[model samples]
Target: MPDRITLTGLRVFGRHGVFEHEKRDGQEFVVDIVAWLDLAPAAASDDLTQTLHYGELAQLAADIVGGEPYDLIESVAGRIADEVLKDSRLSAVEVTVHKPSAPIPLNFADVAVTVHRGRA
Candidate 1:
C-alpha cells in the first residue's frame, strides 16, 4: 500500500475573481492538499528527507495564493496540481480551493474547486 499524506485547512488571502470589485478587493482562500507516496522509509528512519514536508507544501500554497490575480479558481487548482506533480515521489495529488467570502449576491456559505492529478 502506498503511504498517504494530507494537509488541509490552509488559509490565505489573495485576489481571484471575475469581477473588477473582487480583483480590487482580495478575499480569503482556503486550500486543501493531499499527497500520496511511500512513507515507510521516512517513518522507519525518522528522517524528513524520506517524506513530504507539509510545512513546505503550505508555504508553496501561500506563494501560489499570494501570486498575481487569477480569473478562475480552476486555473489556480490546475497550477497547484502541476506544482505538486513536481515531486518525483508523489504518486497522486488532490487540491481543493475554498473561497468563503465570495462576492455572491445570494446567501451562500462558500465556493470551492477540487482537482486531482496522478503521475504520468
Candidate 2:
C-alpha cells in the first residue's frame, strides 16, 4: 500500500438534489478524500514540494462541492476524484460525499457515495 493523505469532514453548502426545493434551500454536504502516493521523497527531504499539498486539495474539494449542482452524490464524487487525480504524483484516490439532509421518507443517519479511481 502507498502512503496516504486524507482530508475528511469538509462541510460545504450546495444546492444539489433532484427536488426543486432542495435546489432552492440547499444543504450541507460533507466530503472525504484519500490520496495515495509515494511519501518517501518528501519524508526524506522534509520538503513540501515532494508531496501533495492537502490545503489546496481541501480547497479544491470545497470549490467543487460549493460550485455546481448535481442530482446525485455519485457525480460529485466522480468530479472530485477526477480533479484530485490531475496530480501525477498521486496513483489513486477515494472520494466520499455525504448527504446528511437528503429527502428520504424514513429515518436515516446519512446518505453518501464513494468512488475510487486510479491512473489509467
TM-score of each: 0.96, 0.97
For residues 82-107, what per-residue lDDT tens digits would candidate 1 score against the true structure?
99889999999999999998877899
Alpha-carbon local distance difference test for all models:
0.90, 0.95
TM-score of 1: 0.96
Worst 10 residues of 1 by lDDT: 1-10
Highest TM-score scorer? 2
What are the runs in model 2 whose C-alpha is more than 4 Å off?
none
For all candidates, the clash counts are 0, 0
lDDT of 2: 0.95
Q: Which candidate's lDDT is highest?
A: 2
